[model samples]
Target: MTNELTDRGQERRDSILDAALTVFVRDGYHATKLTDISREAGCSVGTLYTYFENREELLAAVLQKVQAEIGNASDEPLEEDFNRISYADALRASNRAYLVGYRANAKVMALLEQAAHLDEQIYDHRVARIRRYIDRNRRVIEQLSERGEIYPIDDPFMFTTALSVMISRLAYYTWVEGFFDDSDETLERVAKTIDDIWFRSLGLKTD
Candidate 1:
């Protein structure tokens, strides 16, 4: 279905989505209007409607674009050989990947979190997304524990929830907003601090 769009059509749609993201970020979901997105995209309201049926669809498309750009990178299946790497290497690799991904997409992520609070439908979507990640991590943690690589977590789901919140809030505060210094050194320190916390909590050893 996505392949049906001609290049020009797809470009126009993408432009609309980009504009929608800008308005959503600035004015938030409750305050943003479809006309605002159309104006920002330099398209008429009718044209915008041709691309997206409603604001919800447009917002969903915007989030899908972001997930494809930021979240999908690490969602790729790692090779068997990659999984064969040492426990510590795996932990550090995954943690580093998250820090990099979150840093790169902090603004869009913050917007997503903000939307979750304003709308019940969006809140459900957010909860489902987080639940998916938590389930995956719980399985990974179970595998690592079975392999005797780290301390067994009694409640992997809860741990994943906590870890995800910590990272999300940190990314919002440090990168999206200007609460913390987002310099290279500080990002490095922040990532290291997360790793330290993970290691301390999970009883993970050095590489």
Candidate 2:
């Protein structure tokens, strides 16, 4: 009985967060109200309060949820033997993972970007999330460098940071904001274009 109650409670929380993303994505951060989220969530305002104390609290929860989603997806460390995979194959695989993850959570991602600009707390959280991923990618780049698979870099951190932000920002504006024609062919083309740019910067050649 206790287990069932906990499971159901978590489900309800997830639903509320999902609804929050929907409204945040549609209306953006500055304009969204708790009632807007409640209505979108199909729950009463009181129910929303039961889970989140205030607007700030809900926004915090929403940002954390987005981080958790991406954090989980990126938790796996790169293989120890990095050279086993071809450079182009590695680029394609990483690009696909990033693109798919961004697409899956575009709404939350878009909301976070808008909210981060206005909210100091949220800005810190967003920065932390990016830093964590960049640190991990830095290690991977180092391992690849050890094998001479990647070009020498004086600053792995900045290199990874620049590349990550470039692709991620482009993904957000292009796919999340629907700025581009994201039909299957177009998205595939976008991914290919990104892969090529990334390869050229890293001096990786595809056979």
Model 1 CA deviation exceeding 4 Å by range: 1-11, 76-80
TM-score of every model? 0.79, 0.78
Output the number of the TM-score-best candidate: 1
Clashes of each: 0, 0
1-207: candidate 1 lDDT, tens digit per residue: 244778899998888888998998788777989989989999899997787778887887887787665545544432225456765566566666666777876767787777888767667777766676666566667777887878767777888778767766776688878687778887888778877876787787776
Candidate 2, number of clashes:
0
Per-residue lDDT, model 2, residue 169, is 80
How much does candidate 2 score in TM-score? 0.78
Q: Residue by residue across 139-196, what tens digits does model 2's lDDT show?
A: 7677668868778999888999988788778888887789887677766877898888
Candidate 2 residue 155 Cα shift, in angstroms, is: 1.5
How far off is residue 194 in model 1, in Å? 1.4
